[model samples]
Target: MNQPHPSEHYPVIIVGGGQAGLSMSYQLQKRDIRHIVFEKNRIGHSWRADRWDSFCLVTPNWQCRLPDFPYQGDDPKGFMLKDEIVEYIEAFARKVDAPIKQGVAVTRVRRGKQDRLEIRTSDGDYTADHVVVATGGYDIPIVPDYAHSLPQRIAQVHSMHYRNPGQLPPGEVLVVGSGQSGVQIMEDLHLAGRKVHLAVGSAPRSPRLYRGRETTEWLYDLGFYDLTVDRHPLGDEARHKTNHYLTGRNGGHEIDLRRFALEGVKLYGSMAGIQGARLEFKPDLRKNLDEADEVYARIRADIDKYIAANRIGAPEEAPFRKVWEPESEPLSVDADEAGITAIVWAIGFRPDYRWIELPVFDGRGHPQFRRGVTDAPGLYFVGLPWLNTWGSGRFLGIAEDTEYLAATIAERSASQRAAA
Candidate 1:
């Protein structure tokens, strides 16, 4: 594609054509809004580049639906593998006829006068009245500084680099971070015949399902997953604590620490430090486990109250009822015996706004925006973690967020047109 002149202007330009970007594009198309999406690679690069060979979305096909495209598959509760998701996203772009310039990597985004944005890219420079940073949140993987001191022999890989069992070395693997990625990686490595030791952390206790239905189904029915940042009282609190949102896996499978125990995946307390070949760990898992249990109990009580107030009937109880049970005991393991050969950091991800030279970011590096409008007028952000809700940044959840953002963009564009 030929590079446009630096002075050329587009009505709207979006960076990073992932799920969030695509969704925003779909909404714009529906509104007959002219926009261009600049993608670093082909559409769905993140899903295509993700290393998990056997990776399946935790959310089922039903919950994976986007704004204009609904997931059409045999299993509503079945997890769509990585490849399937990539194809779905590509198809969505085509179906909506979104104007996408693939393989164009954005180098920097700066605010221009009169609510304009200056976007510098590998292909060329372009100005847009509105810019949506739909880059998504998981662009960067976080590895703690403590990991730097590990012995030369101990291999360390972030979860993003992890593909399948074949990529791991023989013997035990130490999976750090008890988040969904860490737990899932530990499960996969263990199932692949490698001894695994999981380092626990402060993780939210989420039920796999509720009332015999998929947890996602219940959440959708109860409008829990539909929560927006505007309506959620705990949005600031939740955002302050965690940057990631936990979703339920498909096929009614619940992820609980007890399940790891049942599968013989050795669990360890929080990792203190790693020196040479030895990894130091806290002796007690009681405090962390207890805290998680309490949180889960409070969530359960809230759900129960919601059910009673709404008079919702309980369906047939599921076999995975044990997930709802309280944590009974603290589990610990010796890092030496577990044969943790590699430490896979599945901790979490943070925003990389270094390339964005806008003065809209707060002290913590998150963009300053209300809805999708930034302090610099035409500069906008969409698909950011908790941009507008508990689920605003999620797959099915982005529809409402995009609609709101697109309307705001249109309003701003109309006002500009009137002035012109």
Candidate 2:
């Protein structure tokens, strides 16, 4: 009665409660494997926490699929908002009866005695034969170094903390990084009557719908996501590529930065550096705009070629608008002169795996893994960009990757049992 029972160990421990973790848990549960998912916050906390109130799925509703669940709404093509995404994940966890330990944030994951993995969490210590870091590689916000150079009087917030226009200070807003987040927030704030200045950067604008079909349809048919990371033409750039510019506002549409500039959102080229109260920018506004248009044309050309080759019947082509219209004066403007009082860093995120005491990262600090399997025999990572394919980091690809990892875990566990 005086001696306490030993802590029971599980075969696998998953370190996130997002879609990736839940998807993996569903597959493992189906295989009757023993595993536990430890989440820092509640299930789907990432979506519930960081995303703006108006944020919706960049992909269509039908693509939001889990193992045992899928988008079942009447509007299959409609986008799901942030709250709906959280609800879907919560429902998925319940449906699979996922063994999730909510509010248990894993502080460390390192090799323990006998090579078993020890995961230290806020709740308690847990050991597992295999550990899966399903923490979808985008937790750490990536703000530019020059952000600190701005006067401390100006407020700065990353996209993760940004919610609505109301949350921002009542003044001109400067949105850095011209990717999806930057463009969307800039548009929303501008429509809300706030003066927004968007710092132009490397971003590819894609049409929301093309030839009466979702652009996603053409991508799926073209097998764009089927290309493996190792074989992608972008080479190492494949891992750190920025998201293409598109917005779900107004039921999804092309987000044109050039048009935004004409519509009063003062556009500046890539931010060079900060000098006292003046912010300097690289004079590449036209260059960046042309590059984005090139990408758009490439996409359209590819789709049209596919349509012609397949003899696919499609609706009449929608009139394409010019991506740019020259302003009477140079589009470049000074942040301080624009009366900017707030700077929101929409620059993307990087993965924070410092807690993982393992030598399995690439030169870029990304995990070294083929698909989800790491070289560390018992350690694995999931839901990372290009882990297997272009889609590996997305909802449609998570289930596929999870299925493979789950099977691998089950097969390896069986072999271990036999040897024992």
Candidate 3:
């Protein structure tokens, strides 16, 4: 007490308090391991803040499983909305009774003397024998460089900050990037009766329902969720792929850009540049729409093949047909003339590991690791997209990944004890 003790120490430290970290903590407790979880904000902050008001789990409720704490709601097939998702996470955190330090931000993590990791946080300093970086991949919101060129008159906000259509300025809204967030936000605004000019990106689309089953259910039965990243056709590149856009809103439904177009939403190609008050778009509107439809068809076709192979009694359905097409590809639209007063950049996010002063990253600043294990001794990562399989990034597989890490950490701790 007189010396103020050097610094707090633990056998293991987790950098995030999200589902991944909590799951890891649960496993560690079961193994009788001591650890702590540090979170910048309270648990479930991202799900509470980043997502829009209408946000819900894109996957079915049956997949909302945390280590042993599976979804117990009556609607196994219904998607849980924003508040429900937060409550689920908070419930898990409470159930596990994870030793968490909320509101404590980890600013830096570097190697310390004697193979211990020094962690600099807002509250105080600490050290640990092993450190697990459970921070999810979506750290920094990405807005294009041309965003700066946008006139100040037009309000700009990333999709993370967007809450609802009411938050936007009244007028036509130009939504950039047609990924999950982009397409959904566009629908949110369009449903609110706001004029929406969609700058469609190359994100693929998925069918919400097919053959009287959710697309996720069909894919699950097809072993898609269990497909490890290593065995994927894209290999590690699969991690960088954009998720196919769908929705779980109002009992869930497919998000078809063509259908939106038919319903009066003006669709444009990917944004190319900003020229004065005019915004330029690529001439690939048709190409983007067609590619998205191709993905939709491929998914249905795969499901059909699986159904036929198993001789299932699923209803036979007709092939996908184009519902609408653009008559002309408008290359440029003057924002002022279009009455666009706001732009929501749903372009997605990038991981910012600059705070991690470790040499375990690739040329693109992405952490280099096999699953969650890195070459750096006693250092690991979790909660990354495709960390092990397609489900690694979602609630569907966090428990399995966490279990693997807990076992790895336990084995290392045992070996150290034996050597001592």
Each model's TM-score, in the order given? Answer: 0.89, 0.94, 0.97
What is the overall TM-score of model 3 with all chains considered together?
0.97
lDDT of every predicted structure (CA atoms):
0.75, 0.83, 0.92
In angstroms, give how far residue 44 of model 2 lies from its true place.
1.8
Query: Residue 360 lDDT in model 3?
Result: 97
**Local accuracy of candidate 2 as per-residue lDDT tens digits, 169-279:** 788998888898888889889999998877788888887888989998798899987888889988657878877889877687888777787788887787777765677
Report the error of model 2 at residue 402, Å. Answer: 0.4
Displacement of residue 120 (Cα, Å) in model 1 is: 0.8
lDDT of 3 by residue, 1-420 (tens): 112669789999999999999999999999999999999999999999889998888888999999999997899899999999999999999899999999999999899889888899998889999999998989899988988998999999999999999998888899999998998899899999999999998999999999988899999999999999899999888888999999888899999998899898999999999977899999999999999999999999999999999999988788789989999999999999999999999999999999988899988788888889999888899988899999997999999999999999999999999998
- For model 3, state the Cα shift of residue 67 in Å: 0.5
Question: Could you give candidate 1's per-residue lDDT for residues 1-420 as a string of tens digits?
Answer: 134434668898989888889899989988898899998888887888875777777777887768967897787777888888888888888887678889999998887656577888887888888889898767789888878887666688899999987887776788888876887787778768887777777776666666756666666767777576667777555555642224333353655675666667766677777666667777546565556666655656666777789988876432424333224333434445556667898888888889988788888787777776788777778886677766667677788889998999899889888989
lDDT of 2 at 135: 88
lDDT of model 1, residue 349? 85
Better of 2 and 3 by TM-score: 3
